[model samples]
Structure formats: C-alpha cells, structure tokens
Target chain A: MEFLSYTFMRRALLAGNMVGVIAPLVGVFLNLRRLSLIGHTLSHVALAGVALGLFLGFFPVYTAIIVSILAALAIEKLRRDYRDYAELSLAIILAAGLGLATILISASRQSAGIHSYLFGSISLVGTRDIYMILPLALVIIAVILKYYYGFFYLAFNENEAWLAGVPVRTLNVVFMVIVSVTVALAIRVVGTLLIASLITIPVAAGMQVAWSFKSTIWLSLFFSLTAVNLGLILSFYYNLAPGGTIILAGVVILLLVLLVKKIWLLLRRDL
Target chain B: MSFLKVEGVSFAYRKERVVDDVNLELKQGDFAAFIGPNGSGKSTLLKLILGYLTPTRGEITLKGQPVAEIMDWTRVGYISQQVKDFNQSFPATVREIVGSNLYSKMGLVKFLNQELEKKIYRALELVEMEDLINRKIGNLSGGQQQRVFIARLMVNDPELILLDEPLAGVDIRAQDDFYRIIGNINQEMNKTVIMVSHDIQVISKHANKIVCFEDGRAYPHCSQEFSYDDYIHDLRRTNLRIIPRHDH
Candidate 1:
C-alpha cells in the first residue's frame, strides 16, 4: 500500500500492465506460429535502434519502432528465401543487431541509459512513456479484433487460408508490423533482454490448461495481467527487478497449472 | 465447357521443373485422382490449380475464369498435404476448426453469428462429427482429425474441393471410410473433387478419372488394366497384380 503512495510506482504499474496485455496477446500467435524467437530477435534490433537514437540525439522509442519494423521486414524476406531454414534468418538478424548495437553503444558512450533499457527500469516510466503505451495497447486490441479469425485461419493452416482467398500476404505484413510495434513498446517496460519471456511466459501458462483457441487467448490475458500486477507490487516491496520478477510470476503460474493437470490425470487413472 | 482447365502448364522450383506442359480438364462434378511416384508433381499440379503456385508457362482456369483473377475463393476448399503438420498441442476444438471455414467467407471484421454457428454444425453433421465438436482437435484420432478438416472444408459449401494425401497417415479401416466420405461428397453433394494420392488401387475404386504423373507430364489412366509402360515395368518387378507406383 505504501508503494502506491509514489507516482512512479503507479505509472510503472500502468505501463507494465499495458505491456503485459499486448505482449502476451501477440505472443499467442508467435508461439503458435513457432516464431517465439522473433520477439527475442526483434528486441535486439530495438536495442540497435535505441543506440542509434542516442547517437543521433532523438527519442529512442520512435527510432526503435522504425528499426524493428525494417528488421522484421528483412526477417520476413529471409524466411521466404530460406523457407527450409527460417530460424537461420532470425539468427542472422540477431547477429547484425548485436553488432550494430555494440558499435553504437561504444561510439555514443551513453552507458547508463543503455543499461537501464537493456535490463529495464520500471521506476523510469514517465508521462511520455504512458502516453506511448496506451495508444499502442488500443491499436493492438483493435487490430486483433479485426483480424482475429483470419489470424486463426492462417495459424491453423496457411495454404487453406490462401485457397479460401484470404489475403494471406497482406495479413502477414500487417501482423509483422504489429509485431514490430509490439517489440518497440514492450522493451520500454520489460527491457530488451527480458522481452522474450514477457511475451511468451503468459501464453505458455495459458496453453497448459486452455481447451480451445478462444480460451487460450483469454487465459493468456488473465495470466499476463495477474503476473504484471503481482510482479509490480512484489518488486516495489522487495526492491527487485520488475521484468524478471513478472516473468518469474508467470513461470510459477504455469508450473502450478501443469501440476494440477498431472494430479487430475493421475486421480482419474486410479479411479 | 470444363469447370476447371489446365493447359500447357509447367511449374519449376528454381531450375528443377516439377510439372511440364500438362493439360487436363474437369467438368462440374469430377472425382479426379492424381497418382504418381514421390516427387512426380501430383501435389504441385494441385497447388498450381489452387493458385498457391503459379505456372511458369501456362494458364489454369476455374469455371472459365483464370485462377489468378478469381477473387472469391469461397468456391474452393483445399486440404493440403501438410494437413497434419500443425502443432498437435494447439488448443483448438473441433467446432472452432470447422468454424474457421466461415472466417474467409464472412470476412474478419464481422463477429461469429448464429447462422454461421448453425452452418458449422451442419458441416460437422455431414461427417458425423457433431458429437465431437466440443472435443479438443488434438485429442481425436488421426481419422477423426481428418474428418474434422473435411467438415471445415464443407462449412463454406465450397463447390471445388482439393485434397492432397488426405489419407496418408490414417489406418486401413479409417482410410476406407474416408474414401467413402469423399466419394459421397463428390456424388451426392455434386461437388468437384481433385485428390492427390499414392494409393492407386483405393483411388481407382472410387475415382472416375485417374491421371498418372510421370516426369512432369500427366498420362491419363482410364482403364482398370495396368497398361502404361511404367505401370507394366513396375508390374514386372513386383510380380504383383496391383502395385501402387511408389510402393513398387
């Protein structure tokens, strides 16, 4: 309760929850599409973008969004060209992003700010950060609502969607753009290093018990909100890293769900 | 006029031409089966017709309209060779899987209506899977999963159904049932079906027309007797009366 007295704590909770919702929402598709690594890879691209922003003396978030989008497009191209070894494309981009980020960080000598972003500093969520996240969350929700079924169709079977005249290529491009924006928005709260876990952990928890696609999505939201809210409060009291704590919270929930499922199965077998 | 026509169509993956100058025609209600050895382009031809792959040097038309130009894909349903390639751990119920057929027909902007829900059940009923609509798709047997996909295809009332190795992983008993269901869809529903299968004997039992693919060119097999030189050559080696191409 004392933690809520501070304005930074409240802002951190708000921004963290926003990332919580959007990251897992996007993560469900990423995990289903077997592109969970894309989040990790793009976050690295976001780092390079941040470093570039510092070098150019501008806002890092905008630059991160631009760089991540371009990197995402490049990843898509590479995936098409090397369909057999698509993961290699992610590895390539990740390497390029790391190299660029390292060079930029050394050249700029902005070590403190970069370190804060690399591991995340929830205490630093300002008014501008909240403003950026709110609209991002809404846009993500709206896009998901508009393309939910089409996305579901593509995830289940891409060729079927194509044959049915679904605008697959266009949808894929839209989806990649959303992913780019998501990576940019998410790095603000979770940090670039922990972005993958923030995106995937909640969705992984949901998959443990969800029986249907709709339920899985809803459950992912539930897990994400719960983890983010709980993690924020816990971190405030314990002086812990918010991003890592949130991920740990999600992991705890997943393990609990799996244990319950196992116990239920064992009891049923015994009966 | 043929409902679907392929004229002088050739497809190549880079420099390797999989299909070469193939010509074929299908009327409104065709139970046409494509058979060949592995890598012989039967599936590739199906993809070319479905507009999933473009031919390097020819044209494919569905209902006299070029496949590339046809915008309304609700008329066509495809169950690809990778039908079973999805993550079995994916959390989707049979009803949800069947309902996805209506996604393209209804567009993504609209919510699922009661009418679409009723249509989903109707499609499930066609495959006698109404009871399992609530079941997790991954929990079902291979044959059941295949039927659910068939129901998914049927939900939109597609006039042309394309199946690639629909029975590739099913048990023998289930395969027979699948063939019957497909045959019924072709005969009773008056739907045009183009199927790719390596099981020539089973396909021959049900299909009205069989096209054997050899080295990118399609050779028609209208007779019950094995007459093609490749077929005769295979027959000699196997010493069996009915040896499927890939099996031989």
Candidate 2:
C-alpha cells in the first residue's frame, strides 16, 4: 500500500497495466498470423529510434513510436514479398534493427542512457509515459473491439479474407501499426527484450485451455493481466527488475497451464 | 451481363505468360469446373476471378464491374488452395469461422444479434455441421473441416462460389461428403460455382460445363462433350504429362 504512494511506482503500475491488457489482446492475432517475433524485432528498432531521438535532443518516445510503425509497415511489405518465407522476412527486419541500434548506440555514446530501455526500470517510467500509454491503450482496445471479426478472419486466412472483402490490405496495415504502437509503449514497462513475452507467452497459455477463438481471447486476457500485475507488485517488494519479473511470470503461467492441461487430459482418460 | 464474366483476360508471371486470352461466361447458378493438367493455369484463372492477380491484359468483371472493384464481396464466397495447407491446430471453433464471414454486414456494431446467430446455424445446418458448431475447427476431420469452411461460405449466402481444389488433401472417403455438400449448394441453393479440380471425370458429373486449360489456352465444352482420350491427347500435344493431383 505504501509502495503505491510513490509517484514513480504509480506511473509504472498505470502504464504497465494498460500494456498488460492490450499487448496480449493484439498478440492473439499475431500468434495466429505467426508474427509473434515482430514485437521483439520492433522493440530493437525502437532502441535505434531512441538513440536517434537522444542524438537529435528530442523526446525518444515520439521517435520510437514513429520508427516502430515504419518498421512494422516494412515488415508487412517484406512479408508479402516473401510470402512463403514469412519468418525469413522477420529475421531480415530483426537483423536490420539490431545492426542499426548497435551502430547508433555506439555513435551517441549515451551507453548509460540506453540502459533503462534495454531491460526496463520502473523508476524511469515518468508521468508522460503514463499519459501516452493510457490513451493509446484505450484507442487500441476500442479499435480491436470494433474490428474483432475482421482480424480473426484475416488471421485465419489472408487470401480468402481479402476476396471476402474484409479489407485485408487495410486491416493488415492497421494491425501492424497497432502492434508497433503497443510495442513502442510497452518497452518502458517490460523493456526492449522482454516485451515480446508480454505479448506472446500469455497467448501461449490461453491456447492450452481454449475451446474456441472467443475463449482463447478471454483466457489470454485474463492470464496477461494477472502476469503483469503480479510481476509489478513482486518487483516492487523485492527490488527486482520489473521486465524480468513480468516475462518470467508469463513463462511460468504458460508452463502451469500446459501442466494443468496434461493433468486434466490424464484424468479424463482414466475416467 | 452474365453473373460472372472473364473477357479477354491474359496474365503473366514475370517472364512467362500463365493465362492467355482466356474468356469465360457463367450465368446465375451455373457450375463450371476448371480442369487441366499441371502448369496449364487453372488456378491462375481462379486467381484472376478473385482479383488476387490482375490480368496483364483485358478485364475480369463480376456483376458488370471489374472484380477488383466489386463493392459487395459478400455476394462471392471463396475456398482457396491454401485451405489444403490449413493449420490443423488453429484455435477457432466452427461457429466463429462461419459467423465471422458476415462481418461486412455487422459493420460498426460489435455484437452478433439473434438474426446473425440464426444465419450461422442455418449455414451450419446446410452443411450438416450444426451439431459441431461449438467444436474447434482443427479437431474436425478433413471432410468435416471442408464442410465447416463451406458453412463459413454459406453463412454469407453468396451468389458466386469459387473453390480452388477444395478437396486437394481430403481423404478419399471424406471426399464423397464434400461433393454431396457442393451438390446441395449447387442444386438446392442455386449458387453459381467455379471449381478447379484435377479429376475432370469426377467433377464432370456435377459441372454443367468443363473448361479445360491446355498450354495457357482455355477450351470450354459441354460436360457431355468431354472425352478421356481427347483430354489425354490435348496434354500430349502440349508435351505435358497426365499429372496426378499431388504431382505439384
């Protein structure tokens, strides 16, 4: 309770909670499309953006969002070009992002400045981050709700969805943008390396017990929120890294869900 | 104008022309099966109609407008070749797959109403899949999975249905059920269909006409006019083999 009174803790918790809800919400579609690594790739791109922003003496978050969205679009384009090698397209972007980030990081010589973005620091999440994260989270939630069916269809099959007039091209672009925005905002909470887990691991857990697409969405949301909040609270008490805690929580939950599913199947077999 | 028309359409992939000066016409409720040996471009023709690949020359119009510009996509349902490579562990249920196709109509509003639910059920019932509506689509047999997709198509009640090798990987036993459902869609629902199949012999039973592609040229004939010897001769003339469906 006393920890909640700290300004930095409050900001970190607020921003982290929003990400907990929306990142996994978006990840369900990403997992279906098998673009789960885009979060990690774009987080690396955001690091480069942060480096550029600091070099130019501008706000890093703004550049991070812009750069991430651009990279997301590039990933989408490359994906279409290499339709058969969709994962190869991601690997290309990841390599490019890492190379660019490494170069820019060394050029700026702001080694210490980049530390918080790499693995996350709750004390570094400012009031501005909360304000930005909160509204973006709400907008993403609303948009996802509005276009839920279209996303599911596209995720299931892109070419069929296009012919059926799901605005496949537009929706694909929009979804990539949404994912990039979420990743950019989430980096502050879970850091560049761990945000991918925030988006994917809860989804992995949800699929273990899901009966349908709707159930998968609900179950993933539940596990995601649980992991992020629990991770944040534990990090606060133990003075541990928030990003590590959130990701570890997600991994643990996925394993537990898998174990439970195994036990339940065994029980059914015995019965 | 016909229900669907492919007028002077020709398409090329990079250096090679895949579809050449192919023209086709279908009235409402006509079942035309595209049959040909491998590399003859039957699937390419289907792609043209779906506007997945635009013609390098000429036009493809559905209901009088270019297919790419057709405003009401719900009027057309498609089961693509990718259905063969379907992710068997996909976590969606039959109901979601069927109902999600009606998304264009459910625009702006987020929830599915009673009417929408009824349509989904009716679609499932038409495919004899209503009992398994809540079942995960991945858990269904190949034939049942095909029916679920058909039900997904039927939910929109589209006028024109395009199926490109819908039974490509389906077990031989389940294939009979697949044809029965397609038969119902054609006869009872009176929907126009364009199906690409390797077995001209089997599909000729259902198709009113057979459009055979030989060396990028299309030859349309009445189903009764099709001869096995003629088809084999056409393949020989083009220096092509009588390709089995699985031979790429």
The alpha-carbon lDDT assigned to residue A147 of candidate 1 equals 84
Candidate 1, residues A1-271: lDDT per residue as tens digits?
8888999998998898888888988889888988899999999999999999888888888899999999999888887779889888899899999999999988995656997788778888889989998998899889988888778877887756765556788888888888889988887787899889988888998988899999999999999999889888998899998878887898998898889999999999999
Which consecutive 10 residues in model 1 chain A have the weakest lDDT in total?
A158-167
Error of model 2, residue B15, in angstroms: 5.8
Candidate 2: the clashing residue pairs are: none
lDDT by residue for model 2 (A68-90), tens: 99999999998888888878878
* Chain A TM per prediction: 0.97, 0.96
Q: Mark the regions of model 2 whose C-alpha exceeds 4 Å error after superposition.
A: A84-89, A103-110, B1-17, B20-25, B56-69, B109-111, B222-225, B232-248
Look at candidate 1 and tell me the lDDT of residue A131: 96
The DockQ for candidate 1, computed on C-alphas, is 0.59
With candidate 2 superimposed using the best TM-score fit, by how many Å does residue A258's alpha carbon deviate from the native?
Answer: 1.1
Which portions of model 1 show Cα errors greater than 4 Å? B7-23, B39-41, B55-59, B108-111, B219-221, B227-232, B235-248
